[model samples]
Target: MLASVHSEILREKLLLPGETLVVGVSGGNDSSALLHILVALNKNYHYGWKLHAVHLNHCFRGEEARQDAAYAQELCGKLGVTFHLFEFDVPAYMEQTGMGGQEASREIRYGFYRQVAKEQGATKLVLAHHADDQVETILFRFVRGTRMQGLSGMPKRRWLEEGSIELVRPLLHVTRKELESYCEENGLHPREDSSNRSRKYKRNLLRLEVMPLLAEVNERYREHILEAAEAIHQDHAFLERLAIEQLEKVLIVRKPDEIVIDNEPFQNCDVALQRRMITLILDYVSKQTEWSSQHVEAVLHMSGGSRPSAELHLPGQLVVSRVYGRIHFCPKGREERIHMYCYELPVPGKVWIAESEVWVHTNYLERLTDWERLPENEAVFDADRLPGPLFLRNRRPGDRLALFGSGSEKKLKELLIDTKIPRAWRDRLPLLIAGDEVVLVPGVRRSAAAPVDERTKRFLHVRVEFGEDWREVFS
Candidate 1:
């Protein structure tokens, strides 16, 4: 049993030599067997791991919870491992957070694990989520309207914190029956949670009732489920890579609060890639937005509609808008202009200024237009001379502008004052940003940064319109 368990721990460098680890010991069959196996490996294999056993008393089972924590500490002591125990009121936490009892308990338990690992300077938080847990999770999620991601089940190893801390399940391939046998042979009398016996819990019902029924139907149901889940996980990972590659092809520009993509390139992608890209975009521009398949379908329908312009508001203040062939996304209240914001202005494309209710679009001109008769809402520049990857943003402090045909630069504040632009509207006005220079301040001033000259081969024509008419942006 020890040899079999050792093979799985070394499956993917789950446990390293001379490293600190925090083991979650619930004094249950699975966790107790996990601790025993790890301790045996550490001693026999000369893997100098500094083990710290952590037990969290969730206060759900009252006296039983106390015994669970005590047993965990005793077991750790017998193995010569440092023990740490923490308590949290799972019932009270559920009340304050409005979470279900089981969900709240797991949340508190995992949080306690993270805290202990951090305190102990551990790199990995080890848990005993065995193969049975994976089979049950996959089966549970399948019955609970979960999609592709859910059917894959829990990962053997995943980062608890992106780079700093990882959570590993060394016994992910181990079965509950195998663990129980291991515990008995090792003389570690692990406790069983009384609550697990209650059929009121959906998981317990599935385990006690549904699982047995499935096993009677086919004794190898657990093995079959595990195989299917592993295949789905691999397929999901492949799809993710394909989606990321497709996303880069269509994405025109991205900012801290906004993302702009070309519909032409986006529509060319496979439906699978398209759906994934939308989900990824929504994920990037959200603050814990709980989006679902319904939201993704709505965005698809909105973008594919007959109208040239449309908009939808999703959870987390995310605003999705379609302007002809361009799709835009930013948070709500971004149009208020109180925050410092920047927008990308793609060459031969358009930018909608939500703050000023203005649309600024660009096009490449074959010849220079008459500047004397040009409207204040339009400007022309040498596309060959201007820098690539243009942007439209508000004025910044200490910004200097080099006027057309002028050798010197002028302070933006002084320029705004000279133009009689109101103080309140100074920060609200959109300025065309090219690389590091302020190229154009809409309806106010134009800079000499990319002036069209006699040697100019391509002309960049920029036109601005005032209003929320996205159709005008497309035109």
Candidate 2:
């Protein structure tokens, strides 16, 4: 097994002469085999690769985790390799991020690995993902309605942290049984993680229960799955290149917080390319490559819609909007607040607020309607007394508003709380601003300073709507 892995690494040119490499050792059979084999290759073949071992104690399983770290440290010590160890509160991370145990552990583990690689100045980080793991990953994604990208499973080599470090999995071609045999044959007693046998986790359940039953049907299931993944990965890579090319042609604007594309060209492309383009944009914007099929389908449907202006809210506070002839993808709150910008409202026209996903319309009225019967979302102002070029924006600090019929002015924050608005929505709520004063808060209040009177000659009618149905708010 070691000879096979060493030959594969050489053929793949995974390691360079005298280059520093960080090996992630979890004290499990796979990592233990990886560390031992690499150490042996260095001694015999003069591989000349500087090896450093890193172990993350995922503050779970209490004493058992500590023991695993200690064992990894001891093994690295015996091999004359520098050992690095760190501890992280993974349970706390899971709770904070609302991620499951497996996801949280993997995220924390790789983050620590990246830090160690940077500190050690190692260009490559080694992982111990094997053939069985690949099979499990493909099967898991298959059961979850994956596309070709997900079907590709894990790549053997990829760049981490924006090419700052390389992650290599040399064990992808090797099986778990072979790794266990290699460890036993070399007298390397790897520490066993008891949690692997637990069925609470999806991966564990698949490994312990589902995979064995599948193996009964065909013992070569792992190899077949690996082959399928390889084929899918090749096709995915080619499509990704084409998608990127298509994106370059249609993408009109690309910024850190937002991306805009010409909808006509994108809509005319092949559906496959469209999906890839959407995924690429999403991954670039979110800084992750884990979008679902449903998300892509939703964007596709929105892109194909005939509405002059439409918006779809996605997970992670992302909003995809189609306006005029362009499609805009932006985070709901590009920063802490929904982009503190004042957009000039067009008179007798409609303006779409990307941050709030609300449409604001202004109309010139010859006569005022009954004030008591008007919807709360609609506000009438005396056009002759109002300032020019009214704008819509979020509330700024120290912003005060005088409600109609109220004697005193109050801060916007105080008004929001009194209205029982959610604290999270306070900063993102839309406010109609004229010059420096907040005139109206949609579905909330109309300022006393801008009320229409009996003597008014012209009236400015403003209304706000949200979502596909343009649900009207009556305050």
Candidate 3:
């Protein structure tokens, strides 16, 4: 059994030499047995690595929790691996945070493990989710109306945060029966977690009850479950790629808060692709709660104009609002506001704004006589002629601007009104300021103070374009 798991690990390239391995030791049979097998493998195979055991204590079962922590500590001591433990009152956390019992416990436990892994400089954190656990997860998500990704179950390895290491499930292909058999064969004493016996959990019921019925029908029931999961996992990967492509093509995104979508794409796409697109939108829009099929269907129904300017308040502060025949997804309380920043125009560099990119080049400076030729959101300035240092910034109340050829002080809002720009659009418009004076409002007006002339030594030529969406292209 160890040899087969070792072969799978090697085949998957799950572990690399010379990196710290942080094993999540729950003091349960699965985790404890996994630790023993990995330690034995490390010693026998001369795998160059450092090992540390992490135990997250939810403090739910009192002495039972302490016993689990103690057992993990003992195992770490016997194996000469460093051990770390953290405890939290999960019940209080659930009440305060409004997260459910299992959900809160999982979030807390994984959060602790990630912090520990970072502190220990671990390259990969190991989990003991065996084949049966994956099957249960797939079934659970299916019952919960999950799309393709959830039905695929847990990934074998995924980066929790890129370059911060990953959570790896090396025992994914290993079964509980196989692990128990291996433990008995090697005379390894493993502690059973008492919580597993509680049939209150859906997974517990499946393991103790539903699985027996399936096994009686076919002795190779576990193998069938594993095979089905593998096939679903492949399908999930394909659909994920498709979803990403659709997101890139049709997603109307605004950074950190808003995403606007046109109804045309969904109305045009096949239902399968439409479901995939919905999953991508929910996942990318915000780190919201697990989206249900009903939520997607509701959004789709809204896209079909089920209501008059309807709004759906989703989990994680996401607000889906329908306005002007487009569905907009934004962080709650953010729709009525615009966050604008005055940024420096670095010569020969790029300026990023919501759904737009501005490239400033010296050669492009000659093309503009008046800023009116610029997009309603762009402007150009003579770099060398600006009063000492130029600054990019926001509009403040009582702010005055000198309209070119008209020396009278004009309010920024009044100028925006004259230009026929909406109040919201005006809020995000970049205002070029030079020494407390509005030098230029790109794509709008330029100050009489700094007019482009042949005497201008260095020119700031800016090219700005807007689109429905933007991405972190450099990164």
Candidate 4:
């Protein structure tokens, strides 16, 4: 195991002789093996490397966590290496940040590691993520709806926090089983946390339940996944270079919290580059570690939209908007407060759309009214066909509507643009929804789900009356 890790480090050019390094030790098999391996290599080869073992006790497991920290310190003492232990309240962090347990733990844990590295003036922070861990990560991201970049899994080494510190993983070629066996052979007596077996966490579930099932189907699952990941990494690396070049070319403004790009030049680039460039912007300004592909597509739609200006409100207070000929990304309180609203419409009653200043009136009738004369402002539907009570809300991303004649669903944003709706008013446009379906867009169009036909016994007469001219608001 030591020989393989050394070979991996040398081939990847992971370390230089006598460089200061920080190794994270969790008192588990994986991290313990990593720390011991580095120590062995340092002494045997006369590398003269300065190694610091850092352990963080996330205040969750009570006595078990404290014991883990103590064990890490004892091991470091036995190896005659410097050790540092820190305790942090992960639950409080999650509560304050509204992040999940796993996400908060990782965020604070890496942050603590980086701080220690900076204090020690070390450039490399080593970890023990192995081949099996890599496979799990790839599978997790695949299930969570990611792009090609995520499918590549973790890199052997990457820069953390804008290239200030290097994060190195020398065990990518090793397996967890091998690490455990090495610990047994060396009498390391690594400590184990009870939380790893908890089924409440999705990752633990995957490892404890899903992984063995996959192994049952194919014993070489880990090798196959890692091989595919390596291939994807190569392809993504090529596209990443292109994306960086494209971003530099189209960049009009760049800042820590804001980015602006020339819209025309961005559009001229290949569709693939465009997507990657936007991802680069997101990495810079967005606070979240991961973003869904739908978020990227929404931004793309906004760029090609007919509206002269528009804004897409993303989670974590990040705002992506188009202004004239430039696209801008702003994080941290760009807008004071978003005015998007939703309201329930009562059947056989009336409700008012506050933003659009229109009244929605619904009535049940034995015979259908002459709604064809004003299809834009009124719709007659088969009462029995509505999925549920009508709901009035503003637009959401991926909202689709089925037109009267069109067999397929049309993206609501594109439909609004086709009708020449102002971007400013689009978000405030009243949409009557029935269950998951958008049944009516007053002064725009109606859904095809609840059609009025001669066979219809009961009727749904829905009408909207604008305080001002409805045409003025929509335009």
Query: Best candidate, lDDT-wise?
Result: 4
Q: Any idea what lDDT model 2 has?
A: 0.83
Tell me the TM-score of each prediction against the true structure. Answer: 0.64, 0.70, 0.70, 0.69
Instruction: Provide the global lDDT of candidate 4 against the true structure.
Output: 0.84
Error of 4 at 235 (Å): 1.0
Task: Tell me the tens digit of each residue's lDDT in model 2 across 1-475.
Answer: 7679888899998877787899999999999999998888888888688898989988889999999999999999999999989999999988897776776787777887888888888999989999888899889888876789889998888877666788889888998989999998999999999999888878799899999999899988888888888999999999999999999999777876678788899989999999999988987776543677888899999999986667898865688877656777888854254557668899989998887778899998988669646776788998777755589888888999877786789889988767655443566677888878888988788887656878888788999876532221121
- lDDT score, candidate 1, position 204: 96
Summarize candidate 3's per-residue lDDT along 320-408 as a digit string, tens digits.
77754456777777646665566665556666654123432223455456554566445556676667565566677877678777777
lDDT of each: 0.81, 0.83, 0.72, 0.84
The order by descending lDDT is 4, 2, 1, 3
Q: List, residue by residue over 1-475, the lDDT tens digit for candidate 1.
A: 8888788777788888988999889999998998888889999999999998888888888898899988998898899999988888888987887777876777677777788888888999999999999999888877765556668888888777558889998887889999998888989899899999999999999999999899999999999999999899999889989988888888876776778788878878887788778887987776244456677888878867776668898865688888657788889876444567788887888888886668889998788657636776678888878865688888888898898776888999998777655443577778887888888877777888777778889888898886533222323
Give lDDT tens digits, candidate 4, residues 143-247: 877777888988888777566778899998899899999999999999988999899989899999999999999999999999999999999999999999988
Q: Largest TM-score belongs to which candidate?
A: 3
List candidate 4 stretches off by more than 4 Å. Answer: 286-288, 315-317, 334-475
